[model samples]
Target: MRILAISHLFPDLKEKRYGIFVARQLSEIHRLGAEISVIVPRVWCPGLLRHTERWKNYDHKCPLCRFEGIEAFSMPYLRLPGNFYNRWSGLAAFRAMKSKALELHKSRKFDVIYATDFFPDGDAAARLAKYLKLPAACLSIGVDVNITAHSSGIIYRHFIKTAKALDGTLACGQSVADRIKAVTGKSPLCVYGVLDLEEFSPAPDKIPARKELSLPPDKTIALYAGYLTKRKGVYELVEAIYRVQKKCQDLLLVMCGAGPEETALRRLIREKGMEHTVHMAGEIEPERMNKWMQASDLFVLASNTEGMPNVVMEAMACGLPVVATAVGGLPGAIGDCDGAILVQPENVDNLEKAIVKVINDNQLRADMRIAARKRAEEQFGVKRNAILILNYLRKIVEEKKAKQKG
Candidate 1:
């Protein structure tokens, strides 16, 4: 089957951290023998913020050669951030990608149009599919609905219309799906297992895995792969690390993301003389994630709110224990897993206690690692989830074909 997916959020070569989950899902769908073409947008950034990796566009090279098997393209567009964008963002995306999408459609007719987020991408997808005379579907993994659309009326208005227009929709977790249903009055398929089991499995050897990532084999690495902001409880995590390190000298916190609070974090690290203890591994590609996940003793995230985070699942798949805040879909995802520990968000003492507890127990860590890998495969492996996604896409295609015949 041929599928054309459009999104503004995705990882290109340089911007590996842009949307790692989006890349993983598309890659798996391609692996399942679907011919896929992807179109993404690169929005204008001010010169001041352009220096930051977060704001820099993943420069387009050869779109055809971007990934292993999929055809990828990047379109440029001007989008003023905030309220101004709600009305025109969808139209802007459709205009930027229209010509390229049409040209690609002629060469290989797409069975369906797929979108990642609802508002802008769904808006673009709904309009483009209508224009091209094709069926369209979309998937939202939480944030776009619960956070962005919830906060802004324009974004909410656009996605609500798109949601009503689309033939089908999928959501990562049920809480967000329910919210989407409430807002748009259209329920979505609640889907999970969005990571490749093979890519994220346990390392054959920890020393070699640590060596590959330049992580010290002697230390206990606690990997945190999310935004570096107070809202994410990064400050609480740092303080917890400091307190835990006095008792456990081998503990190392490797933060694998970037955010607004980075400058403050650096200052805090300096003030606490934790420059060596806390290593900042600015956002990295999902491809390199297996190495980071396997080399670490445990995965940690202290987010104030989240859906089922891709990181926790990836870490579990890599056979690592997890210590995370008991917020959002986390409680449902890993709260009961033997290798995982859930603590209250913004609680430094509790976070420290859990870290020290998990770090000190060698047998517990080893057992948890095994259980974590088993649970991940049984629950969240891509083999199960990707097939579900492919099947749903196939259903969309079949439905479209039937409609045409009728």
Candidate 2:
């Protein structure tokens, strides 16, 4: 059990599906044996802001990158760019990787110090675990704390003063562990992201996944995948797909990631004419998102907030049928789960009547596509959420060895 994960949220080798679920929860906590390393940071990107669009994927070659095979690093510091001084980008990414975190803590002698973003990756792993005394933890993953440190006030007082130098904290739902106990009263441990139900199952249907992802033949679609901003409710999902295309005119929605409000949501979808009912598609590739979730049928997330959203359990591990939006940790991850539905955030006629009742019911979309892949195989598996992050980072590394044996 040797970890040292600091974060700008994982993913490298050029944003390979950025933070691919924090690189599948540290490669399922290094296949349960543990031993992981990562550092990410990176925020310099100047030089005419390296050709806009968020610094054109901020120039890569970020010192020593390797994801799936763990051992990662990308440090690069200096702040005050966009995100107006992100409350001192985690102590300036822990003073630009404090001497490479003390030269990789004198050669991999780590026991703990993980984080996945809560002000510059949990404020640079709680200041590099207070100079390597070890034990520091975090996970939070829901808009860094329900909307970038609860929409700042000096980044919510430096997120309750660096989450009291964290010794443990984990979340992804339970509404981001009740917004980190309503802003740092701290009580994380939520557990909700990680899905590799064999790279999201359910195909062999939806007409061979829309004939191998060419999609749209005989529409009905509905997809949506993340970003395109407005807190991902994506302009109330293009105003409920322009009133469900004035009555499901062979409906279709599509969306899929890429942010900074994609040119003002494509100019409000061509001034509301919705150019044949919204279909952006943009950024795709987390291994082709399971053929756009088994070529879509139903899966929408008009999110105004969320802590539980790995594209709503990869659209319920590809069996589709979901609707989303009962804000963060999505009503305890798809409230009562029978093939998900939730809705409410920024309403839009209750997300256009649950996307026109799952696209005009056909036996309630085949019983919510078999209860949404049996609730992603009895709940978000991926080695049971990486053994709840390996027994909560091995009980905070045995509570710092009982505080160094009292």
Local distance difference test, per candidate?
0.81, 0.80
Query: Residue 111 in model 1: shift from native, Å?
Result: 1.3
Using alpha carbons, what is the TM-score of model 1?
A: 0.88
Backbone clash pairs for candidate 2 read none
lDDT per residue, candidate 1, 1-406, as tens digits? Answer: 8999987777655556666677667888898898999988667566777666665542444132255566778777667666557567888889888999999999999988989877578778989998888889888867676676767675677667778888888887777778778866777777766777888899887899888888898988999998777768888899999999899988899999887898889899999999889999987766788888888889988887776788899999999999999876677667778979999998898999999988999999899999899888887977677788889989887888898899
TM-scores for every predicted model = 0.88, 0.36
Worst 10 residues of 1 by lDDT: 56-65
- Whole-model lDDT, model 1: 0.81
